[model samples]
Target: MSVDKRKTIFDKLLGSDIKAELLIFFHRNPSFSGSLNDLASKINKPIEEVEKAVEDFVKLGLLNEVKHYYFDPEADKELQNLVLEDLTKEESKSTFELIKDVEKTNIEVLDKLLPDGFPPSGLILILSDPAAGKDILSIQILCTKIAVGRKGLFITLDKFPDEIRDFMLEFGFNSSVFEKENKLVFIDCYSPQVGIKSKEKYSEDPLNFPNLSILISRVLKELNSPIVVFDSLSTLLQKGGVRSSLEFLRSLTGKIKESKALCFVTLNRRAFHPAILAASEEIVDGVIEMKVEETEGKVENYIRVFKMMRRRHSSSWLPYIIDVEKGLLPKT
Candidate 1:
């Protein structure tokens, strides 16, 4: 019959090249009616191979074969345009260059109590209680960068992008800004535990970084963004163990120093091992430690900028609150 034109066409078009290229060939030589031999000689493919391919294309209704074969320009119009599309190739490098270039700028967003430009390209840590606002504050830091047209990567070990989005909205950010602009990207670490996609994603390419470090490294190298956030280091060490995870983090901090990106890392104070914490302390540019003290029924929390190496941080903890409208409000 009519070859069920739609089904056969889509199936064969899986390996099809641009229709525009075929059209150009026809334009070059208006004498287009050809057996596979004539078309292959013109197009520089082996006639035998072209014969089989043409047969498949004809079955798909993308070609017509009467005395000779001719392409049906309408059969796979949209797919043909995509096959002919050269856009993805040309703009890839510049996008990557822009992402890598963000590290050299001098502008920094620091605490109000501390000086304005804190830890410009340095590594920083957010240490806090399990349920504290460190993760929320980190998201605010990212949204702030995104508002300025800068980009950030969230390599989350504990939260999903949707949950992070919900958390952002809870902190007063409209999630659409992230969805529309794509200034924020998520690398789902999901867990240090061996469930679901973690182990496979971590080990998929054996040639890459060992365990979590490799995952983080490939991301930093590939991303040209100005900021990166590792949601929680404690989880990795707890799950992947001291030597593998900690060594990877140590190497990661070193690798990150070569770029201009601001690396904001998160760590859990209670569960974090001494070696991991020590590695972070020695390598990162600053540490923002969050702790809670209980007075009767109320529990109070504070953030101390314990150390900011290159940038001068004040003597004590910088106060910050999670404001409904403003997200993370730095106390003066």
Candidate 2:
């Protein structure tokens, strides 16, 4: 039986430097066959340890062992390319001079909006009017982060996990692959309150602020530099009241910052009072606002950076349109 390549590679390939060296050697010398002792001496590792690792790889169909072990050229070919590509990228990075410490969200418009890209541990709030596509934009940002080899935690307050997954698939993002690799997680706060049993591993009542915070903290601890997206904060404000929601935001942002992660929270600008919106904005590191206007029976969407702490951004509302394949795009 062939072992799951994605699972094995994600879990074990980076388990140790020894495993990496072994895999690299096998990939580079696909046709090479050697005994356990020979392979151990080649990589300068102990025969006992190498033999165990080699057997594990053989079981995973990465290697074929008849008289001696050799790389299985046809085994998980796609994953093999991904592994090699990732390893090559690491090697290339080692040769280059580091430019900035911030992680790129991989969104083109952001390059113009945030000149420095997204700073680690920054909490960004997305405020939009009804049907302005804030939820779609947030998910796109999350998917973008995941595409760039970062993990993401999406806390769904207004939608089902399945709906989110379907949306991801519609945009050509494979949510299943991300979930299987443990790179994308969904906290189904919507399901429990809707009286539908959640299929997610992490879930809590949306109204239970304390339990929700604990659940989020536990998941955040397991991820590294993850991108977190709160579908919409309006649900929190409605369910927990303005004061409790503000307190939760402060606590959650602090936890996210401590983890050195990035979080994007969504909110409906018209859902609460102006004073409440001002208070909410105070808790965030930056704010991006979106709105739609109908003129002469034609409707258009626009987005702008309302406030970005310590960063220069274009406050001018730029026109935008949603594409079926691309979640959101700057109007050309």
Model 2 CA lDDT for position 129: 93
lDDT of 1 by residue, 1-332 (tens): 12253334333532233222243365344446777677878767667666666776677566789989875656645444433232222222222111222232221324443454544565788877776677767887877766666777777777655677787787566757654565566666664332455422232221123655656667666666358888777766545544455456667677678766788888887564232344456456667777766789976666766666644455465545656656555555
Off by over 4 Å in 2: 1-104
Displacement of the residue 275 alpha carbon in candidate 2, Å? 0.8
Tens digit per residue, CA lDDT, model 2, 1-332: 12264335544443444555576566557677888878999988988878777766776777788888777667747554565455334333333224356555577666667665665667999999999888789988988878978899999999999999998898889899989989999999999878998888988997788888888888998987799999778888766655667789999889888888899999988665343555567578778989999999999999988766655566678888978788778888
Minimal lDDT window, size 10, model 2: 88-97
RMSD of 2: 23.0
Please give the clash total of every predicted structure, in order.
5, 0
